[model samples]
Target: MGRQSILIVEDEVIIAMELRETLEHLGYMVVGSELRGEDAVRSAGKLRPDVVLMDIHLKGEIDGIEASDRIARSYDIPVIYMTAHSDQETLSRAIRTQPYGYIIKPFNERDLYSNIEMALHKHRVKSRMDGSPEMVDSAINMIAGAMVITDPQGHIERLNLEAEQLTGYQLSDVEGAPFFTAFGVSVPGRDLLIEKLLVSSEYGAGSMISFPSTIQIRMKSGGDLLAHLSTALIQEKESLQIQNIACLIEPCAPDTEGRAGGYQGAAALVQAIPDPFACVTEDGGVLLYNDQFSSLCERLGDGISGVALPINRVLPESFIGSLAFFHEILVDNQVVTREKMVKYSTGSIVYTIRYLPVGGDTGGSSRCVALHIRDVTAETLAMHHCERAQGESQNTDAAVEGIGDLCTALKEKVLAMSTAYEQGLAFHDTAHERLAEVNRILGDIDLRLIEIEKNRWV
Candidate 1:
């Protein structure tokens, strides 16, 4: 091998140039560079490089996944995917292409170099296998999920990178160990289940079984991971005997909340929120939640032991009644809001419930919903006070208007009295009685005006 050659396929010009320089510095020959998936496929066939570094999202009718598929089928070249997206859907699609390695973007030079060498080595090993069952080892390493392969006696033969990370145990430490002991599988009838699976495999090749219940994997770091267990028996074609037992372990819940130490950073972020926050699955299962959420559940008289329980089991009945709203948010992928008042023996508390859809395409089904509960009792009470004050202000304005009208009527009466006095002077004897009556009426009017003014202020 004179020098290993690599091809770069990326949409970003700057990133492509930087990757090329890095590869050159790492002593690998840069065969060619392409921006579009179509061009990358063409170049891969022509250049026939040792490894093709392909980006998942490229600028063309075909994405890097399709291009890699075409290259693998046409040229049998190993392609190592370079991507920034780590979503389940994207990973599933890329894994289907059977790439030699998958490296996330913004990686250091050591990561790039190591992945490149590993891809080359795995590709060479696969080629040397020449259609042997051991070729399955390379395929297993490429999978995105945790996997473990055991011998016919159920002793661990090999485990994948994801399995090592999930269990916090290396292959050197767990090789030849019993599967259950190595994984710390906690099931009531686990021994019987394994015996049945082994006995059933004697009947024929390709015997497989899926564990129905959830499995709790005890990690090396003294933590437990809740996962779903699936196993398939691999038999020799000629011997028709059980050769190996392949076990695929998947999280019992969604990635947002599953795995013991998988989402520590996200968990910290959730814990930082002052309000009660939780990520609830579509089926009302609690994934990630903060301590505030736990306290809220306790306050509601539903104390939960751990985060693995269903949200309905611990939340208030009012929240359970909002199942329709939760379904709507998951279906429509929209934010919804409602208010609920929980009355305890002591007092009542008001909460503004917000449901926001998370991790799904627009107009598509949501993976889960984030539940944020805000204490808005004080805000609600302040709003009520402001509304009452406005009502009182309106009433005061109406009273002042009435007082102004009364004053105008009093002035008119005074003007009429003046005219009567003038008439009394004209007809001295005739107007004398009228003047006396006017004087009494004027005194009554003066007393009534004073009373009205005093009442208006009060």
Candidate 2:
């Protein structure tokens, strides 16, 4: 495939040229470059680039924000804003354009690449969910949870894309199959059956039903996934008779709290995550957490069997800085992340914790925040090792040059013994200095690890 194309729109010639060079260096083809919003809009409509980098301030009658809005309304193109403007009025106007991302001026290459990649991914996902569907198939696919609709007799009628993906069976393959055959659900250490749950009495023609506990669903491929299942009886409006039963299954982790309602709806989904994660109320009460979280708590000597404990008390002192970020979530209503190197007797471990607001709204009205903790020690250590190797390679090149100089001195006939001895001493000193530098790096790493351990306990 050809390189992804980009269009640059900036009133400033220098910034536009520099941005084009950066994009080309990053392997993106710069298809069009324009200084005015009108030209940009015209070029975008004609060239149809993969993405556009637009500066909020432009030279013509319409600004970059207005141009982006026009392009989006006309061609569904994604536009990323680049600007130095930080005033509220400017920001308010830029946001209304719904740009893919906003990058502050003087941003690094990494920031630009990350924003473009994310914007492209989001655009692709949105495109996938916008295709035509028959009946309520469109609505079904839009749901985040897997759903299957069955006839009143409990025969499979329709299943959404998520359900098909989860069960490893397409809707066509399971069209006439009984709900049990298609979804093979079972409770661990219990004799519960999918048929038993579908019986009319449990979810009668009149009422809906919710699974009492977390159940393990066996996919057609023979793999098991944990989920929370709920059912609703669809009724015909005119006859008031049951039409079909809709089974909604969402990923969830098992909970000891046994709390019911909307909280459980997405609880198992959080638990299914491999990372040590927890959802806590704004006031610090634990709402839901995965088994990895419980295991981490045990390792830290924090009792986490209950539903209500301040997060500050559950994690080790290594998390004190993370706790402050959690507090900041309520203030900025934005995701806060922290990475810390931890010292253990065996070696150092690096942990990164992120506090993400539960809901999409950035308003402070969000009542809960989700905490995700991951051990990035291996990657962090690998990066350090790579840097150290590069430094050592440079030192080796310098030492090779010194050796070449010593050889040249020996090859020249009139070289003095004293001078040769001095060169040898210099070489010896250089080697010693390099060794010391390495030791210093190691010492610094160790000390940082120790400090982390000390702080963790405090």
Candidate 3:
């Protein structure tokens, strides 16, 4: 980081003097001038220079190559090999130390300066690359965060052990899947992410808004996980930002069932306890509708979910964006609470809608979000009159317990392994109906094959 110091270990006095002159001219401080390999190693230990310039073929059995390796390993010093022995055998031996740079004997001052500068540059770059793991470990490992590094094409590269363990899909299963195809959630601003990402000119064009958003994704086991995501391009090339996406899930707490999701999965239980629930996707469409949810709104159909539901049916179009509304039951993904409300509804009907993240294949582009709905319209209103509302007092407990239970349940469900896996599934209304349906569907083609018994065929 500071002005670099170089330790010169050339045995030839003239060559050593010449190299020192060249290094000094190139804005480097000559820390030590040594003739013997052992002396050079000792001097390097004392000087603790920014770098070491060692000549490979020394006078003793412990050559410059061995001395350089010791200097590097012991003192964490950067070494550049400088020697007249440019032959294949000697050069191969010198390279074992992974020296910063290699320069042949009787090199010119210009070449010498270039090598020194190159050595420093290489060390700096190496330092930068190697610093990341430690930095990442310090920040993410203890706080329960999931860090995913991806290639330019969005294939999974390296996921921390925690991320691999939580998602239920190993790195081998998910490495090269397309980001969208793997994660399944339709990215809200795919055109924008690719807008500048796939092209050279617009890579950093406008003031891009960073969404501190939470979205849901499904796991390899078909259950969903709630991931808190902050979407940004980490490493940028000319056209593409080889991204490093980070996620920190608020650990879901223990429930009445004596379970807890490691992070935010605990609160989803309380969020699911109420009736008349509907989930809205990030793209502003209805994702699901529970049975009681459909009945409350007078809409009933088997295949009513997984499609956009019009929001204008319940509240006036202009009221949707009104800022005067507030809820009593809203809780941060990291915070657990019981009685959050959606006060924006007409007639002031309060509903508890707990949000969860559903990560799909790659997990960063969360595909689906869960809305655990609980209708608290009447209780919420009655509490306004009764100063000593019991439910209101336990609002925090109910909300926390409810969401926590569901989240814990879901977390277990998401990571569960199934041995009773079956392929063909058939559903029917009644016992007779099921038999009839199966028989009709199979037609007269369904005949049992005879099992051959050994020797005793009666």
Candidate 4:
């Protein structure tokens, strides 16, 4: 109807006549219908169609699939596949042809028309969707889903790149086969579903259970396959109608709730993550507390849940006094911060208490006391440990140097004794004095070690 001419390359005479009649009824002009692959290839030179319907199991040396490929490559026309055999190997070959969709054999006029219409519609939709700014839409066309467009009769009218790849039917081989044949085994209660759709609104949709079967297909050439599948409905215009369909099958984090959902512009870049974080309100209240807060209490052996709901119930005694200073910030609606060492039952933990006050017409709203309590205890300990390590390293280096000096002095003393033995002079007091100094240095170092152990809790 829209100047889209179709070329039908079907071997069967009755099937070819039916195809031409269907094409005419659907408002598509048929350029040619050839019974053999060689004749179809020759017809391509005489009559050009917007699309070719190529059957996989066609007559003669050049099969319909191969002939379509040659015509498509040389003349640049799109092709649809028709086939009775939905075997894996034949379908694989059909997909390589990139036909629009397959119409199964023994198909009715409605089924044939639906296939042609759906293929044309999908081609149009692809062009329209690509005009959008989103790259995601284009990516959808490439995903591994069987894209079947069903008419009001539940007949497949259209299919896309993925459907061609999945079913293994050449568009020409099965253009008229019932859609049920494409599905092989029947769906349970499907007849009931069709009845419900007749009673329901046009946009109404539902799912039906399909059979559990794997097909080992044997083409005339003998190819086999076993595929698992289910069926769903999409009655609305261009509606996304399927089970287990991911619109975007790529890496993207979807925020369905919270501040993350509200984050616009730059906020999307700097939101608090899953671990321990704080959100300070304007007036004065701890709006949210997460798993890390509970963990902090567990380490302290205290059941800490309620104190901060309005505020933390089990807050450390040190933090309680800081709260008064924080209250003043709320009164003045000003921000104030205090870092304190919070004591648990076992030991003390350090926290940097940051306060952000909410200012209103009169004063602090009282709803806005955003206490950003960070557990800086680990960081503080790490810094202290690093300092102690460097200090010990320096001390050890000094001690080793002292030991080396002691060794050198002792060797010199032995030489002095040998010289005294030869010259009959005294080498006595110098050796004793050197040994005494070495012992004193060692005793001083041992006392320092004891002092370090005394302050071990830090």
Candidate 5:
């Protein structure tokens, strides 16, 4: 918020003094001046000025350009080149440093002020673009409640840290096994109904089904929890078929509504995700989808239940074209991530898509895939605008620089013409004097010739 400080790195004592005076007159604080490139580099790293005015030809072996490079790599400070030399090789080397501005010497007050201000503005803009991290791992690990994601066929695909703590099973040991086997779930009174629902054809395809009775889940450590069970289906986008299932168990209090008709706890975990999530089969069937997915479908005018829209229909065309990349996860069983940009009538939307393969086989292919989609439109737009701002700023600086160069060239040509005109005037004055002298000599010779003729006649 205060006046910007500048570090002057010039070899010539008079020039450096003049530069310091000019900067101070322009309301910039001139920090300690350094004549040597090595000294300037050290000072820049220590003082950390807003900008550095570096002279191309420094006193020592290390030139201004080299010092600027070192400072740039370490401190990211903006450097403006001050040089009288305009040779091709020097220009090329200086350009590689990408100095904010180049001031051709015998620079005036106006040139110094404009270049320094522009460099400071550019540096500030760049600082804003480079911000802090978006997400923190410690924050995610602190969330309460167990979360379990399973493949289309009900195999335990993943268990979060909370799920591991609650289920008394490490993810590495229980992953790829059936959910019931991993957690050891048992419905004491409604065993028959649960068995039927678990093996039913509709359940395999990720149908939403819940039990009214209390369910008991036993941890591997023999600790048991009595909870109400619920299930939500994640469907594949292409086939309108189910791909995965999410099961939520809540400790049901006595006198709570046990009839499964309107109870919401079963799918509450899946619904808690802020992003659209789905589980798809290896063959592209919709197994399970969260409420966010349903909302997204409705917004896109593609009904999830009525028309069974494929994943491609829901995502942008750019994302759809990369479907093969998603399928590769099933083959290699590694997580694949992709980002897509979509333009709508309103504006552009960016989606960060992550495809995670599911199923428990060590060497075999995965049976299902889980997709977590994040709407990163806001962040993406911010980044785009930032880049565009930086570019426009650079373009503006370049235009100013071009104008300055043209002015400098014009000034040089004008000086050259003035010098030539002065020389011509001097030449003309000398020629006039010589002509008068010649006339005077000729007149005297004529007089002498006349006197000689008169003497002959007498």
Candidate 6:
């Protein structure tokens, strides 16, 4: 393959020149350089470079994060952020953009090369996987429970953020490491079960194995975690050979049976709701959801077959922003309501989501939050129509009032002219009668106008 091409986007001229020199020295083709975010976006479209080295601060209206988001969504280009600041707020915004890699400023040649190569490799892998690896990654990270994906031999390929938190091992530390060794599992017949599942998957006999009971997990922090473990084999489409094993680990409370019974009762109660309703833990895990919620998930292209999954995984991302205030609901014992406009291929939908604290002390910690979603599309549309109609009616009334004023002025002028004609004409008697008739006609017309205005609604 030819040398990978890169674009440098930095406002500082000195840093931009130094970056170009380093990239060229590392045997990379520097396609273009820009000092502003807007220029960088235009250059990305024109040059179509393999990777972009973006600086967080830029000299234009938009910053690097915004520019990178536009480029990724519009051109599907990979961006690696290079910044001097390491503040949490900056990092959080950058992570939302989903940059391929992030390198702090004053990075070494080796660091630059590695980030570029990794970004290229990941982009290639995503393309090979039908261009949805980013989506899959987002979905995985959105999951409330810890999840790990490993090769058939049990070597780790990738794991989500929750998994990293649970295992206390980052992806960089455990990539290609044996899963069983990295995080110890204390389930009986765990090895035998994995071997059997692998063998069955290889021969196309079975593709999944789920453990219903809770198992003990030896945490990296030297604490024990009780979790429900389930695994499924991801197979190659045509070959039917196992490519990877997906392990879903949901942490459970010690009172598992009692919690299960409570969930069952809650589920029965929520089933009576006509709208989409769900009860989620404070940590965003679904404890119980009604069928309408499940159907809504399916319609939104996120189908949920079990509880304990993350609410983010089951709902659209646009709607998840409101749930971020779940803690506030718990603490204040207040019902938080938000409305979101979701556009579908067929039409737009307006949903009102209400978050209420469920059985928690006032101004104290809460265990669960009830999420109720109502389809308010029709109601919203009707309200808009009503407002529009009222506005038009007001406009019409104003126009009618103006015409009424004009008619009254014209009537008074005609009456004054008739009185003068009746007084000055030689045949004053006949003219007086004619003027009387004209005045009466004008009065009749004014009365009719008043009646029309008064009965406008009718």
Alpha-carbon lDDT of model 4: 0.51
The TM-score between candidate 1 and the true structure equals 0.38
Scored by Cα lDDT, where does model 3 land?
A: 0.51
Question: How well does candidate 2 match the true structure in TM-score terms?
Answer: 0.40
Candidate 2, residue 88: Cα displacement in angstroms equals 15
| Candidate 6 CA-lDDT value | 0.71
Clashing pairs in 6: none
Per-residue lDDT tens digits of candidate 5, residues 244-316? 5556555533323232222223234334556887766666655556778778766655547622345666654
- Error (Å) of candidate 6 at residue 261 is 4.3
What is candidate 4's lDDT per residue for 1-458, written digit by digit as tens?
46678888888876787688877877789988888898888888678777777777787988877897788678766666677655555544554454555555545444555456545544454445532325323433543455444444444444445655555555454444445554442332222333443233431332212221112222223333333233333222244222121110011122233332222211211133333433334323334445565565455435345322434344444453344565677666545657778666788888776565432222214434544467678879977998998887676666666666656765665565555555543644665554565566556656655545544534
The local lDDT score (0 to 100) that residue 80 gets in candidate 2 is 85
CA lDDT scores, all candidates in order: 0.71, 0.67, 0.51, 0.51, 0.63, 0.71
Q: Please give the RMSD of candidate 2 to the true structure.
A: 19.0
Clashes of each: 0, 6, 38, 43, 22, 0
lDDT of 6 by residue, 1-458 (tens): 89999999999886898799989999999999999899899999999999999998887989998999899989999898888664556555665566766665546564686567656755665544652667667755654558788877879888899898877877888789777667766443333334455554433211234442235566778776656666645555455456676676766534422333444434544676678988888787888777898898898857887778887888766675545677677667566789988888999999998886654322334567888899999879978988977876776676667667757766765666667676776656655665676667667667656655655653
**TM-score comparison, 1 vs 6, better candidate:** 1
TM-score, ranked from best to worst = 2, 1, 6, 5, 4, 3
Point out the worst 10-residue segment of candidate 4 by lDDT. Answer: 243-252
Q: Which has the better lDDT: candidate 1, or candidate 5?
A: 1
Among all windows of 10 consecutive residues in model 3, the one with the lowest summed lDDT is 447-456
lDDT of 4 at 51: 72
Give one digit per residue, the lDDT tens place, for model 2 in 311-353: 7788765563445556678567666778877676788778888
Identify the runs in model 3 with alpha carbons over 4 angstroms from their true place: 130-458
